[model samples]
Target: MAYPQELINEVLDYLDSGHSVREAERRFGVGHESAARWRRLRDGNLRANRPHPVKYPQDTVRLALGLAYGGHGFGLDEVAVMVGVSAPTISNWKRRYVEGGHMDIPEIDLGEIKHLSPDGRARMTDEELEEYIHKLELKAAVLEGTVKVLKAEGIDDLSNDEKAAIVDALPAGFTVTEALPEVGLSSSSYYYCKAKPERPDRYGRARAAIREEFALVGGKRGYRYIRQRLREREDPIVVSGKTVRRLMAEEGCRVSYAKKRRSYSSYAGEISAAPDNLVARDFHAEAPNEKWLTDITQFSIPAGKVYLSPVIDCFDGMPVAWSIGESPNAELANSMLEEACGQLADGEHPVCHSDRGCHYRWPGWIGICAERGIVRSMSRKGCSPDNSACEGFFGRLKNEFFYDRDWEGVTTEDFIGQLEQYMRYYRDERIKESLGWMSPMQYRKSLGLAA
Candidate 1:
């Protein structure tokens, strides 16, 4: 027997026009219960001949109900302010009207409410979801591998996303097996692919063993030399040249090489008669006046051809006396020797040694050494090793200092200063293992000699 608000209003209006309740009910299609309520309202209004009191303003009630229907979830305080009513009054009205199931009489139309369809709620297909999951897993794996490689290479700042991108860009079939040696990773991880007997179970352990041996021998031997030594002792394991090279590079191994040059004069006559071990003792003395070793070496300095006649002391290894001029004549050599002798201490008679250079063999230098009471020692002709100490020093000086230097910005004076500084550092600081692993100065101090 329920009736819509429209039907009730229609029956009530009909009754106001003096129609009976039964007639109004029949015309408006209202049930008996609804007709009874309309009859009561009509009779009461007729007796008073006055309009019925409005329950709420049409616009206010419509707005309140519209907000509720729109799912705004506004509280009574908020709704009351918008509808121009007290919060308590709105609360009571909401309880009496809405909670009590009173019919809503909306005066104006509210826009349509939107609800999602099944298709809209479920956008992604099973296939698409599976593809996304697969991509995520692949990306995660790629990032993990990239991080491993980067860490091995000592590059720690790479971002996770960048690492993932790098992993993705790797060759399609690339694996950690390919990266092992290049990135210096553990060998066990790499062995899963090749599983060759040649592959060492632990690369780091093998490398450590090789390095310890290399350190013990003082790097005087190359990889082949060390390998031969190891083989002679019946060590079954074999290492490749490339692996040794990489290890040597990592360990900062020192290497020596003779400068390459086209053959000029073989000095066959002098080589045939050259004596051995005539100049084995290394000499250095304190102050400029002490023990002197004189030698002549050729140079192509920018100022035409020049011969350097340097008289170095055997004590502190300082070039106390030097002369640079056009030709290495006996006069030039004698003059340098005389200059070094003049600077010597009182009663100090140093032994002057040299190869059979034409200047040293001449009577001028010979007479000077004899008059100065200096013991003259000569190496047999063409035997560079007979003057090994001086030759080795010159070779190192040229290769490590002079040969590598840029002469473009240097004047003669600048060159001299630079050479002086180099000699100072070489004597006082640079450690020479050949000199019992101490600097020349340190060696002198160890022997209780003044440096």
Candidate 2:
């Protein structure tokens, strides 16, 4: 059934040894047809040696016969593997053999099968495949040129459905260069098909532009003033204060108060009465309310000159009591001292330190301190450092609170109310860098002091 190389060689050797076909078939697994084919090859070679006219070589015929015999019942793939050719080439040879009834050797030139039609001739000549490809290339170039011209004229705005219809209408397997240009597109149009749409209006562009203009003019005017100015001029857009504030932020503009000259004096006479460490040596205190510092500072509120006297503890710098009145007399200062004394424990003689202002010079004030066992300490006259704690407190109050506001609009009552809130916040919440960045209440708690 199957003739291996070894079997074919064995059959040939048996024939060469003068063995009969029947004997060779019995010795080798090869059939009688294989023995007859091998003998035909040997006889054809011997005839070629006589050299009358060797038109076709015996080896060529032998190769063809071998391929045909191997491909007898085998598939093209199997025949290709056996003969060392591609499966398609094997298929072509098999097709030629079936149609022409002979091996389609290169030496046999069958004068162009002209009886067949053009399509049939195409099927016959393998070289004709190149001509077909060249024609396709030419058609693609023409279509590509047409698309470029149409795109240049802006007449190629076809919808996706229309474009797809155009594409599907073309011949199948047509190159992109050929197909795209017919619809007035470049080869790149196939890839970048969709056009970019128009951009929509920016929502806050008008407001943003107005804000930028306001900032460019300098944001010294209030939002209401600016709005009034714009309206009086009959501007295109009306804007609210909130919108102006938003615009101001966008334009990096800030409205700040202008600084004024210091209007109050820190003069306090009669400081020669007290000795240096006897009445005012150590400023340190271990806990809140242990020692207190007091001073009078003046502020110009809308209600006219208001005197603010605040009592602060030396230990944690906590404000114990404060009062704002029209005068810096002894009554106002004593009232604030009395309120501060109320915070002290019974029989507690907390040292009270202050500059010898006219308030501390009054007998009623001294009597109150004497009754409360409060040691009254006066600072050296004209030396602010002697009462530096109170001076520092006043500086912070002005820097952080008073200077940032339009003071011309603030009343005494409003200032007092805001001061109360600030005092509470400062004592209970605000962290002090001196107290390890902890609040006064927190520092007191850490030192085991009662509220």
Candidate 2 lDDT at 248 equals: 58
Candidate 1: segments with Cα more than 4 A from true spot: 1-292, 312-321, 325-327, 342-348, 435-438, 445-448
lDDT of 1 at 4: 79
TM-score per candidate: 0.39, 0.41
lDDT (C-alpha, whole model) for all candidates: 0.58, 0.63
Candidate 2 stretches greater than 4 Å from native: 1-262, 266-282
Q: What are the per-residue Cα lDDT tens digits for candidate 1 across 69-146?
A: 446665666666655557666555556666667746243332221111234325656775565455445545556667
* Model 2 lowest lDDT segment of ten: 107-116
Error of 1 at 189 (Å): 3.4
Native-vs-model 1 lDDT? 0.58
